[model samples]
Every structure is written in structure tokens, then in C-alpha cells.
Target chain A: MQWWTLFQKELIENVRNVKWVWVPLVMILLAVMDPLTNYYLPQIIDAAGGMPDDTEIQLPEYQPADVVMMSLGQFSSMGVLVIALMSMGVISGERKSGVSELILVKPVSYLNYITAKWASLALLTLVAFSLGMLASWYYINLLFGALSFGALLQVLLFYGLWLLLIVSISIFYNTLVKTPGLVAFLTIATVMLMGLVTTIFSHILEWSPNRISTYIQQMLTTGSVPSDLTGAAIVTLMMIVFLIFGSVYTFRKKELAS
Target chain B: MALVTVEKLSKKYDSSPAVSQTSFQLTSGKCVALIGPNGAGKTTTLRMLSGLLKPTSGTIAFAGMSQNSDIRNSIGYLPQHPVFFKWMTGKEFLVYVSRLAYLSKPEALRRAKNLLERVGLAESANRRISKYSGGMKQRLGIAQAMIHQPMLLMLDEPVSSLDPIGRRDVLTLMEELKEDMTILFSTHILGDADEVSDEVLLMHEGKIIESGSMGELRQKYQTAKIKLGFDGDLRDYQEKVTALPTVIECYIQRDVLHVTVQNMTAARHDILTAASSEEWPLTSFAVNRASLEDMFMKAVNS
Candidate 1:
């Protein structure tokens, strides 16, 4: 019940700050723009008027699933950064403003406090990402061809986990730091470092949570789940659980100092 | 009826101790002022008692609780500079905090309404807290703290940041509140402490140097004195006042002659008789008692 109350405050704050509006808007714009830009690329290049008259540029044909994948690709970079930026101040900003001191003095536990934040951010990420992916799926079918709904659902479930992992990382750093900007920077840096290591040693790091993106891409195009998909998903879930517990622990120690 | 007892409560930040070996007891239904100058660890002691900051070494025992039970349910705390969710309305903020204290929604709303009215914030209850004046926000902060109906309400520097009028308003509110529950408020301003608190705990250099009822502290540090103000220069009467047999020491400070005397009655009779006989200009004559400022200075410096 206490967690529910805290969650309501968090959700209300997100609504008041227009995170509900702009976060989803940004996601939809990125998702829809991918399909729109790809469909009109040849004309866009022609309209630039920089190419010679005899130049013949042959663009590759884009399947419906490929356009969706490209949209997720945009999300992988810009969208992940947006989630980090949105959630970076969840705990640290409250502490800095001294509101956390007042709230924590009540009969509220650290676990409830941390989980309320995580749940609120996760809810926003789920709704915003679902709307973005649905809009992209609609555009993909309209501009290109028909795509299976089951494939889109699979893509959403897998990729949504990756987005939630970013949210957890952002919240974890918020508990460790005083400045929201530092939290954002640290979260982004951690995600990028994980991606870099996974890419450099793909064979050795096949069990990494970063491999969820690869499984996402494979599901989008080939309609077949990779053998390591469950392993990567489970690892990602475990990492999220660990980050949450770490957040609760760190928050208990650092709350007074902040 | 002792409400809370703290023993050997200490807090060390890094290597320096912020609060050291502070021991005190709070009886039920009294306003106790934690009095000290800045950096005297008043805020540190309040925070540890409020459960906002953990003490380095000590034990705080409430009257009816077990050793390791959560004591926060019985305490409400307001920080010196309280920052709320500026986006929340005054009413909404109170209700939100009450809910965190484990009240059901209906009970939360009911208490929020009652508190807003009690604090004279009913009209502005629907307004966003960001739009509140400093005093109004302070009233709201107090309301939120009391929403849970804690037995002990601790405020750190409650009236130090307000204008004269706002200070009076909060002081009046605090006066009304002390009738019901125990209040422990910290202040560096001696006048506020003197006017409002029943007992005072004086802290200096991380240690509580003095703690007592107002009358007891005054009696212990009282110095019998008389102040004389003349229409003309004080230096003229300064010599005459010093020559009186009852006067121990006569000094001029800010155009007034402060005469420390051996006996209050003898000094008054002697000075008045001398002034009348010599036809000296005496604009004001006051029999003075030692103020809280003097007591605070002596306690802190001692």
C-alpha cells in the first residue's frame, strides 16, 4: 500500500512534467520517421539537386520487417538515450531537492521507495515503447507491405526488456550520485560500454544481456528464435533484479549524505 | 511521563564529530527548544532523532517501543528548508504524505482537510505549493509533518527564515500545537526560544552544555543590574552612578548606563535619591534581569 502511494506520486509527477506526452511523441516520431524516410529516400536524394544527371543510384528494396528493424535501430541509439535522460533524476533529484528527507522520515522503507520509482519508470517505458512500436507497425504495413502481428509482438516483448534494462541502470546510478546529469552520463556510458564489449567479443559474450538486441533483430527478419535468446533474456532480467537491489542498498546508505 | 530518552547520541561526519555524547529526555506535552549558535550540531541531533540520519554511536529509546522497532511512526520531522513536490497542490501534498504514513485514502483526505484548516491554509489548499509564500509553505510543511499524528513533532529552525509577521504566525501555531503533543524545535535566535519554549537544551561545539526550564536557567545565570538613560550625555551621570555605594560596576553601552549592583532594592533607592537630589536628567530607569542572550553566551562560552 505504501509503495502504491509512492507510485502514484511518481506517476503524477511524470504526468505533470509532460513526460507522458513528449516521451511517447519522441518515440513515435523516431519510429514513424524511419519508415517514412526510407520510403521517400530516392526522391529525397533527387530533391537535393547535388547529384550529376547521369548518376544512377540503386537503393536496396526494404521489406516491412526491415523497416521495423531500422526503427528499432533508431530506438537502440536515440531512444535509449531518451529513456536514460528521463529516469536519471528519479532518486538523485529528490535527494538534491531535500524532498526525500521529508518523505523518508515517514514510515516508508527504502525498498518501497526504490521499487516505486522503478515501477513508475517501467510503466512509462512500456506504454511509450508500445505506442511507438504500434505506430511503426502501422506505418510499415501501409508504406511497404503486410507484416505479421505475432512478429511485432515478439519484437516488442524482447526489445521492451532491453529498454527496461536501461531504465534500471539509470535508476541505479541515480541512487549512487548526487547530480542528475552525472546519473544520465553514467547510465549512458555503462550501456555503451556493455554494447562495446559484447560486440568486440561476441563469441565469448553470447550469454550477455546485450545480445537481446541481436535476438530482436533475428526475430524481426527470420521468424526464428535464436537458441541463446532465453539465456540473454534471463541474464537481462537478472541484471535488472540485481540493479534494483543495489539501488535499495545504496539508497539506504547515501540518502542522508545527499 | 517521559516520551523520548536519548543517551550518548553522537554523529561523526568523516573524522569530525557533528554531535557528541548528547543525552536528554523529553517529557510529554512540552515545547523543548534545542538552542545553539550555527554549527553547534542542533540540526544533526534533530535529524538523528527524526530517523533521517543515523547516529555514529548511541541509543534512542521511546517509552513504549522495543529496542529495534521502527520509531518513525511516532515522530514527524520538518527540515530547515523544506522542499516539497512543487507540482502538488497543498491539499494534495498533505494527502500524499499521509498515505506514505500508511493512512487509507479517505483518512488521508480527511486529515489533510483538517490540518489545512488548522494551519490557516484552507483557502490556499488547492493552490500549487510552488506559488506559496515562504510562510505559507512553512505552514504547509508543518501540516504535512503532523498529518500522521506523530507523538513528537521535530522542526529544525522553524521560524528562523520568516519575516516578523510570518514568524509570529508560525510561533502562534506552534504555541497552539504544544498543548497536544511534544514539540522539539531548534533555533539560534534566543528571543524565539525564550518566548515559546518551556525547556531549553543548549548545545555548543557538538555538546549540550545546558538544559533546563526557562525560569531555572534565568535564575542560575541572573545578575542583578539597573539600566539608566539620561536626556543628556550618559557620561555625565556615569560618574555619579559609579559613586553610589550600592553600585558594583557602571559602564556606558549604546547611550545607556548599565549599573551592576550588589542589591536590587538598595541600588534602586540610592540611584533615584541621588538623581532627585542632584537634579540630574533621568529619562528612563529600568530594573533589569539577565536576558536569555546573556545566559546563552555564558553557557556557550563556559
Candidate 2:
């Protein structure tokens, strides 16, 4: 009940917080605007060059499944931006304002405070991703033909994992840096670093035929999606653990009298 | 009955001690003033006592030990400069903190609103804290500090930024609550200290310089003070009075020659005799009592 009270406060204040709206607006623009541009790009290209003589322009086949996949994938990355933007001051802003002292002084432990923040953000992302996915599921069918719900579910799960990954990164950044500005900038920096490292390692590992990517490509190309739940379950569990435990661990050392 | 105790408390940022080996006791219903210049560990000590900063080494015990579960509900703190969520109204912020402090919803609202009224901020309580002036924000800070009605209230320079009116408003509220709560407040404003505290704990260079009631310290530290005022050419008369036996400190200010004599009864007689003999311009010669500020400066400087 007490955690709920704290969560409610964060929810109210965070939703009212200007950054929350700004970050989502930016994401919404990316979600809808990019697809619209891609849909109209061929026509724009042909009009710009005035069309070659006696040439027939072949339009790429449209699939509502494709739209959903493209939109979810791009918006999934945007999810990281939203979460990072909203959570930049998870630790440091309170420290700056000297509220850490007042808050920690209360009966509430640093654990509860950090957990409440993570839970609030998680709840927010769950709802946002759910709504965005459910909406795009229709918009994709409007532009293309019928898509499989199973495919939609897979894409949604992928988007969900991406959000979880982002939250983990945010919580980690929020934990490591106790200053808001540094936390925000460092979070973005860490994401870039992670991408760079992953890209370099992916290239290096591809030389010997990477196992993880090979399995994923096999699942995609050969329609051999793994029936076993082990990898997905483990990743989901780790994401949950990282969010709750990582936040509490980092928050413990933070002085409430910040 | 030490309501709060700090033993062997120390904090170092990298290497230098912010608060070094500091220890003190706060009894129930006793107002202890933690006085010092900036960086004198006043804030650090306050933070440690209020459980804001973890001491690099040492322990903080409330009513005996550092178990927060038992004591967390009964400690109220107003930081040196508390930062509030600007979007939250003062009342909302206070209620939120009160809820975090474990008050029930209705009780939380009641206590928060009552505190706002106590601090003379009831009308503006609905306004966002971001829109508040420095003084109003300070007042709001105090109101929230006491929302829990904690057994011990630690205020860090609570009224340092207030204008005269705001200072009086807060100091008056503090005076009223002093008998009801243990106040561990910090400030360099001797006037506020003299007005509100039962005992003063003066700090300098990370250690307490003195601790006592004003009269008690005066009785122990130095000779008595006597005010001797005489009409006409007080500077010349002050010179004569300093020359008198038993008189220690004599300074003339605008025809009032204030004299601090070692023995008041003996000095009175000598002054009367000299006035009659030398025909000095003397309308009156009386002893002026010392204020706590004088005694405080003596202890700190000593």
C-alpha cells in the first residue's frame, strides 16, 4: 500500500512532468511520420525524375505485417529514448535538491524508493507499448493485407524486450550517475557504446558463423521458431531482475540527505 | 534522556573531513542550536543527525540505537535548502511526504494543512512550490518538516533566508512548539538563537566550542557587566571611569559611558565618590547586563 502511494505520486508527477509528454510526442512523430514517408517515397522519386520513357514502375508489395514490423521496430528503439529521457534524474535530481535526505529520513528505505520508480516506469512502458502495438496492428492491415496474429505477437514481444532492455539501461545509468545531466548524457552515451560494441563483436563473431545470430536467422528464414521457452524466459527474468534489483542496489549507497 | 546521539561521527569527501569526530546529545524538548560559519560542519552534522548523509565512520542512535524501523517515524528534518518537485503544490508535496512518513490519507492531509497554517502559509498552500519566493519556500519547507509531528525536529538554518517578517513568523512558531518537540536547529543568527533556544551548541572547526545556558556561561566565564551612563562629554567621563578601581571594560557611546566593573557594589561607591570629588557630568551610573550574544562571542573567540 505504501509503495502504491509512492508509485501514485511518481505516476501523477511524472505524467504531468513536461519531459514525459515531450518524449512521447517525439516518439509518436517517429512512429507515424516515418511510415507515411516510406509509403509515398516511390511516387516522390518518380515525380522528381519525371519518369523514364515507356518504363513501368513496379510497386513493392505492401503487407500490413510489414508496416507493423517496421513501425514496432523503429518505435521500439524510440522507447529507449523515452525511458531514458524520463528517468535521467532518477537519483541525481533528488540529490541535487537535497530531497534524498528528507526522503531517506522517512520510514521509506532507499530500496522502496528506487523500486517504486522502476515499477512506475515499467508500468508506463507496458501500457505505451501495448497501446502502440495494438494501434499499429490495425494501421498496418489498412495499408497492406491481413497479417498473422502470431507474427504480430512475435513483433510485440520483440518490442517489449527492447523496452525492457532500455529500462535496464536507464536504471543502470540512473544508478551509476547521481547527477541528472550526467545521468541523461551518460545513458545516451552508454547506449551508443553498447551499440558500437555489439556491432564490432557481431562483425568479429560473424567471421566464424555466430551461433546466436545464426539461430535467430534460422528461425526467421526457415520458419523454425523455437518451441522451447528457455531463452525467452531467461531473458525476461533477467530483465525483470535487472530493473528491480539493479535499481535497489544502486540506490542503497545514495544518501537521502542529498 | 538523549533523544538523539552521534558518537565518533565523521565524513570525508575523498580525503578531508567535512565533519570530524563529532559527537553530541539531544534530549527531549530541548532546543540545541548548532552554530557555525559555512563549511563548519553545521550542515554535515545536521545531515548526519537527520539521516541524510551516512557518516564515513561512527553511529547515530535515536533514543538509543540506529534501527530506523523504530525511529524513522519520529524524526522531522528541514534541510538547509530543500528541493521540492516544482510541479507539486505545497499542500500536495507536504501530504505526499506525510504519506511517505506513514500517516493515513485523511490524517496526512489534516497534518499537512495544519502545518501549513502553523507556518502562516495556509492560503498559498495550494500554489506550486516553484512559484514561491525564497522566504515562502523556506516557510513551506518548515511546514512539511513538521507534518509528521516527529519527536525530534532538525531544522538547518530554517530562517536564514527569511525577511524580518517571515523570520518572526517561523521563529514564533518554533517558540510555540519548542516545549512540545526536541528542536535540533542550526543557524549563525545569534538573535534567532538567543530568542528560540534553551541551550546553545557552538561549533568551530568541526568541534563544539561551548554548550550552556547564557547566564550559566556568563557566571562561569568572566566578570559581571555594568552599564554606567553619564550625561555630557561621555568619552572624557569614560576615561575617568576606566581609571576607577574595579572597572574592567568601559566604552562611551553617544553620552552613555557603559562600564563593566569587576565588582558592581564597590564600583558604584567609587564612581559616586569620584563624581562628587571631580565634579564630573554624571546623571546616572548603572550596570548593564550582558546579552547571550556577548557571552557567545566570548566563548567562540576564546
Candidate 3:
């Protein structure tokens, strides 16, 4: 019961701060720019370039699925950055300002606090990513060709799980870091570093959470899901669960000095 | 029966101790003051009792609870400087806190409104906490603490940061609150402890130096002393007064002569005779009563 109440508080905080509205708009903007840019690149280049008149540049024929993949890639980079910025202060700011001392002294459980934070961030991720993807899908279909909505939804779900992993890690870091800015830096650094490492060893680390990004792209471009989809997803979900529980455990023993 | 019994409670940050092995108990329906100077561990002790910070080694047994049981539901705590979500209105924050204490939504709303009225914040209930004055925010902090109607209320330096009016407002609120609930508040000001507390606990250097009712503390530390003031420097008379047989020692404290003596009756006679005979320009003279400052100093030195 208290969990539900605290979750509501989290949602209210997000809405009052306008993150619920602005974050999705940012995501939609990033997603929309992908297909629009790819569709008009050659023409835009010809207009902007002070190049010699007779030079003919060859460009590959673009596909709707490729446009979808480009937008997912945009979501992976800029989209995750936005998620990190939005949720970084969820716990650390309260601790620094002494508000956590006021709330934690009540009969509320630390698990409820962490769970509330994770649920709110997850909700934000779902709403923002869903809106952004739907817009991207519409643009890709118009600019390139008709693509399977079913496959688009599948890839979005897979990539959404990956975003869930990032949000969980961010929340876990929020408890450990002392400042919001540092939490943002650390979370983004960890995500980018993990993405680099896993991509470099893509075959050997088949079950790494970062593979979801590649798997989403592969599923869209080839019209077939990755063979390691289920295994990598199970690993990612397990990691998210572990991070949430770990955050709860750490917050329970945390000494709130402020 | 005692409402709370704490034994050998100690907390160490890194290796250095902030609160040492301190033990005390509180009976039901009593207002106790934890008194000390800066860096005296008053805040640390209160934090431990409120369960906001874990002790390195100790046992705290609240009434009807086991030694290690969670007693947070029965305790309300306000830190030295209470912080709130600036984005929340005073009423909304109170309601949210009440809900966290397990009140249903309607009940939470009812209690939040009631507490706002009780704290004299009803007029500004809808005002954002960011715009609240220091005193209003403090009153709201207390309202949130009392939202659950806990058995015990713990406040750390409730009025230390307020203006005179703000301090008076919080102190008056505390006076009214102690009538219904047991309260243990910490303060560095001895007068604040003397103002409303039924019992006073003096702490220094991370240890409890003395604990008693205000009357008992005064009686225990009472002495036969005389105070004298003159138009001239009082230090000139310190030597003359010390030479008298009944006078044990003499010192000057802010233009007043404090003469500690063996016997009040005899010392008064000898001092008065010398003042008249020597034609000293005396301004005021009287036998002195024990002050909380004097007692606190003695306790700290001892």
C-alpha cells in the first residue's frame, strides 16, 4: 500500500517537473530526425556543397527497415542520454538536501522507495520510447516503403528492454553517487563503455545486454530475429532485477548525513 | 514505566567516535531536553534514537519492543535543518508524508489539513514550500513528524536557526505539543532547555555529563555566592574581597563581582561593610542564584 503511494509521489514529481512531457518530445525529435535526414541527404549535400558541377556521387537505395534501424540507433545514443539526465537525481538529490531523512524515518521500507523509483523511470521509458518509435515508424513508411508493423513492434520491445537495463543501472547509481551531475556522468559513461566492450566482442559476449541494440537492428534489416534473442533478453531482465534489489539493499543501510 | 531505555549507545564515523557510550531513559509523557554546546554529540544521539543512523555498538529498547526491533512507526523525528520538496505545496507534502505513514488517502488528507491548522499554517497550506519562510517551513516539518501521532517526538535543535519570532513560534508550539506526547528535543541553548523541558540531559565531548530535572540540577549545583557591580573596574576589588576569611574565591564576569564563599550570611556582612567603609561606588549588589550557564560550565569542566 505504501509502495503505491510512494510510486504516486514519484509520478507527481516527474510530472510537476515537466519531465514526463519534455522527455518524450526530445525522444520523438531524435527519432524523427533519423529517417528525415537519410531520405534527403543526397539532395541536401548537392545544395550545400560548393562541389564541381559534373561530379556524380553514388548512394545506396534506402529501405524502410534500414530507416527504422537508424532511428533505433539514435534512441540508443541520444535517447539513453536523456533517460540518464531525467532520472539521475531521483534518490541522490533527496539525500543531499536532507529530505530523505524526513521520509525514511517513517515506517516506510527501503524496498518501497527503490521500487517506486524504478517503476516511475520504467514508466517514463515506456511512454517516451513508444511515442518516439511510433513517430519514427510512420516517417519510415512514408519516406522509404511499407514495412511490417509487427516486426517494428518486436524490435521496439527488444530495444525497450535494453533501455530498461540502462534505467535500472542509472537508479542503482543514483543511490551510490553523492551528486546528481556525477550520477549522470557515471551512468552514461558506464553505458557507453559497456556498449563499446560488448560490440567489440559481439560473438563471444552473445548474452551481453548491449547485444539488444544489435539484435534490434538485425531483426529489422534482415526480417529475421537474432538467434540469441531469448538468451540475451533473459540475461538483461535478470540484471535489471538484480540492480533494483541491490539498490534497495544499499539504501537500507545508507547513512543519511544531510 | 519508562517509554524508552537506551543503554551504552555509541556511534563512530570512520574511526573517531561522534557519540560515545551514552545511556539514558525516558518515562511516558515527559518533555526531556538534550542539552550541549556545539560539537557535543547532541544531534548524533538524537539521530541514533530516531533510528536515522545506526549505532556502532549499543542497545535501544523502546517500551514493549525487543532490543533490536524496528521502532520507527512509534517515533517522529525532525532533523536540525529539515528539508522538503520545494516543488510541493505545504499541504501536499504533509499529505504525502501521512500516506507514507500508512494512512489512507482520505485520512491522510484529513490529518494533513488538521496538522496544518494546528501548526498555524492553514492560511499558507497551498503555498509552495519554496516560498515559505523559515518558521513556516519549520512548522510544516513538525506537522509532518506528528502526522502519525507517534508515541515519542524527537527534534534536533528545533529553534537554533530561527529569528526571535520564529524561535518563539516553534517553542510555543512545542510547549503545546508536550502536553499530549513525550518529546525529547536537542539544543545548544541552555535557556531553551530551561524554558520547557521537565528533564535536562547535559552532554559534552560525546558523553552524557549530567542528567536531571531542571530543579534537581539547580539544587545539586547551588552555591553561596554574591554579585557586586561598581562604576569603576570590578577587578580592583577581586583581591580585597578574596582576602576576607569567609570569601573562598572572587572573579569578575562582565563588570560584576562573583564572590564564592564558605558562608552566605557572613560573607554578605563582610562584603557590605567593606563596600560602605571603603566608599566604593557600588552600582548594584545582591546574593546570586545558580544559573544554567554556570551549571553547564561546571558540568563541562568536571
Scored by lDDT, the top model is 1
Candidate numbers, best lDDT first, in rank order? 1, 3, 2
Give me the candidate number with maximum DockQ: 3
lDDT of 1 by residue, A169-202 (tens): 9989998998999999998999999999999999
DockQ of 1: 0.74
lDDT of 2 by residue, B234-297 (tens): 6767677788878887886666777777776898888888889988766765665666667766
Candidate 1 residue B147 Cα shift, in angstroms, is: 1.1
Candidate 3, residue B134: Cα displacement in angstroms equals 1.2
| DockQ-based CAPRI category assigned to the predicted complex of candidate 1 | medium
Q: Evaluated against the true chain A, what TM-score does chain A of model 1 have?
A: 0.96
Can you give the lDDT of residue A158 in candidate 3?
A: 87
Error of 3 at B230 (Å): 2.1
Q: Write one digit per residue (lDDT tens) for candidate 3, span B1-302.
A: 68999899999988889889999999889999999989989988988888888889998889998876778889999988899999999999999988889889899999999989989999999999999998898889899989999999999999989999989988999999999999999998888888989998899989999998889998888877888888987778779889999998888888888889888888888988998999889899888777788899999887
lDDT (0-100) at residue B8 of candidate 1? 96
Stretches > 4 Å off in candidate 1: B243-245, B277-279
